[model samples]
Target: MPRFSANLGFLWKDIALPDAIRAAKRAGFEAVECHWPYDFSTDSVNQALNDTGLPMVGINTRLGINGIDDLGVCAMPGREAEAKGYIDEAIAYAVAIGCRNINAVAGKTGSTDEAEAVYRRNLAYACAEAAKHDKTIVIEPLSHRAAPGYHLSNVEKGLETIKAVGVANLKLMFDVFHVQVMQGDLIERLRATLPHIGHIQIAAVPDRGEPDQGEVNYPDLLAALDDMGWDGYVGAEYHPRGTMEQGLGWLKAYQ
Candidate 1:
């Protein structure tokens, strides 16, 4: 069976982040992931994970003051220094919390070519920094519809950027929801790109709701992952339909 990690970023929106870690544990999740953990005191969150025995699978790089389009400053020209600072902070936190994956976003802008160049340089630097902590760095492709002007908006671009960086620790954060929205053929694409993927995230397509409510057939999707011999975590990254408890029905089989 595939192991599922609750994405506390969306799963427990109703509680404090420290409390959310407990909630995910009580709800039967063995692991967790968050968009960013910098807002809360790192010590408190680390203690919670220790108490609950839930490994935090991943967290994202910080994107301060920049627009929603500017999530990953690393890819934005003129912000290389700012990006490195965020990377340094993220690496320190990941080491402190015992987490190993960091998702770096590529912010969108006017010139795709320039942004790609900047993204390549920044990702290469990030890969080197992450390797120091034995951490894996991932670049995710956001849906253009959800995030207009985002530079890394599709798997093709994401792959090209990864190649450009040419770092062993650098890989793609294969998000099913975004990929489904941007391009279909999840199985084919997943199979073709499985080796390049470092982590996976899922939710409903068209709507960011629970996997059960979306068009995605998660059972089949997960089964495919199982057959592919994927050993990484499958993050449940979705908004609840009602209470988070109600949204948990789909997870019983996997659990």
Candidate 2:
């Protein structure tokens, strides 16, 4: 069976970061990831992970100028400095917590060559800095429906950017939810992008709720991951339909 990682960003949003990590452990998850755990000290987070022996899989960079309203600024023109600052901060935090992947948010921008150029340049820098610490930089493609104007809005764009960056440490965050919304060929896409993928996330499409409530068949999808020899953890990144525990029945299949 494939290992599963609890995404504290959604799974335990009401609790403290350290407690969330502990919660994930008690729930039988092998690992944990988060959207933003910056509010908590790395020491606290480290302590929880140490106590539970659950690996911190990955974390996302800070949002852009608009904060909650903006997803990121890495691909936004003229915000290169801001983007790098977020990248540096994320890397430092990830290192302190022994986290493996740093997600470089692409932010919102027009589908222009300049935006792509800026994104590529920033990714190159991020990859170089992260590689120094033996950390990987992963970028995800947000669906146009969920994040309108987001620069990296498709897997093809994300893959192309990784290739253009030409760095081994840079890879794609294959988020199943967004990919299903933007494109439907999940297995084929996974086959094509598997080698370049650093992490995988899953949630229900359309509603973004519990995995079992989605249009996609997660059991088959996860089985496909196993057949493909993927050794990485699949992040359970989704909001609970009710309480976190009440919606976790879907996890039993993998356990």
Candidate 3:
């Protein structure tokens, strides 16, 4: 059976960071990941992880004043320095917490040529930083409609960027929800692009809710992963339209 983990950044938005960790433990998750532990101190986050004995699967870099809901690092022009700083912080945090993956958002959209150049340069730098700590940096592609003009909003484009960078530590963060929205053929695409995939995130299509609430048949998806021998974690990166506990039922059933 596939191991289960939760993205507390989305699931427990209403509670404190430490409380979110507690809730994930209560929900029977063996591991957890988060966008940014903004609400809690590093010591507090460390304490929760230590107490729960739940490994942190991943953690996102800080977005600074833009915050996670607005936009983040990859969008700003001439912010390569700032972006590097953010990535460095995440690398340090991941090393401290024993995390293996770090998800890097490409911010908002930029001009095609400009975005491409910036993304490649920034990711190359970020990948080098992550490699120092033996962690992988996965670049996520949001749906085009959701992030218009953004470079890296589709798997094809993301793969191109990764190839351009040619950094071994850099790979794609394949989120099923975004891919289902922007590009169809999840399984085939996953197989074709398996070499570039470093991490995976799952959510129901349309609703971005529980896996069972939408059109995705996760059993088959998991089976595909098994066939491919995917070694990374399948991050539960979804929002619960209802209660958090209700959302966990699908994962429980999946296991």
Candidate 4:
């Protein structure tokens, strides 16, 4: 069976981190991922993971002051040094917490080609840092509406940027929600970019809710992944439109 990991960052926002772990465990998840365990200490995170015996499948870099609201790493100009620091910190945290994947945000939009080139250079530097710790940096392509003038808004563009970086540690994170919103033909895209895909995230297409509640037929998607022989985790990275437990009914049916 394909492993299912809950994204605590979105699911259990109201509960404490430890409680979130217990909740996920009770909900029948084998692993969990989060945006950043900012409010909790590394020891706290480790304790929860150890207690539940759930692998920390993935993590994100610090989003600066605003957290998830202002999720951009490559958007800012001349802040490559700052971005590198964040990536380094995330890498250290992931290593300390036994995580193998780290999601990197391609900040906001840039002006000229020269500016975009700088962003790519920064990504390469960050990827090199992550590679040192055996952690892969998955670049997420957000919808153009969410990230205006964003450098990597689609799978093709994201793959192109990864190629430009030319770093082995850099790979693509195919978020089905964002991809569905930004571009259609999900299965075909996944098949075409199978070689470059390093991580996957999913949610309902229009609402970012449960998989069963959305337009995407997840069983078909999962079957496709199985056919492709994908070995990575598919993170549940969506906001629950109702009670978290109610939203997770789809997972129960997976088995």
**Which residue pairs show collisions in model 2?**
72-107
Q: What's the ranking of the predictions by lDDT, best on top?
A: 2, 1, 4, 3
Q: What are the candidates' C-alpha RMSDs?
A: 1.3, 1.0, 1.8, 1.8
Candidate 1 per-residue lDDT, tens place, 11-45, comes to 89678888999999999988999988887888999
Worst 10 residues of 1 by lDDT: 63-72
Winner on TM-score (2 vs 3): 2
- Residue by residue across 129-153, what tens digits does model 3's lDDT show? 8888889988888886666645567
- Tens-place lDDT per residue, model 4, 125-174, is 77788778888888888886656666567888788788888888888989
> Which residue pairs overlap in candidate 4's backbone?
73-107, 74-107, 75-107, 75-108
Candidate 1's TM-score: 0.96
Best candidate according to lDDT: 2
**Residue pairs with backbone overlap in model 3:** 109-149, 109-150
TM-score to true structure, per model? 0.96, 0.97, 0.92, 0.93
| Candidate 4 segments exceeding 4 Å error | 65-70, 110-112
Distance from true location, Cα of 12 in model 1, Å: 0.8
Give lDDT per model, in order: 0.86, 0.90, 0.80, 0.81
Candidate 1: misplaced stretches above 4 Å? 67-69
Error of 4 at 241 (Å): 1.7
For TM-score, candidate 1 versus 4, the one ahead is 1
- How many residue pairs clash (N, CA or C atoms closer than 3 angstroms) in each of the candidate models, in the order given? 1, 1, 2, 4
**Once superposed on the true structure, which residue ranges of model 2 sit more than 4 Å away at CA?**
none
Write down the TM-score for model 4: 0.93
Off by over 4 Å in 3: 68-70
Best prediction by TM-score: 2
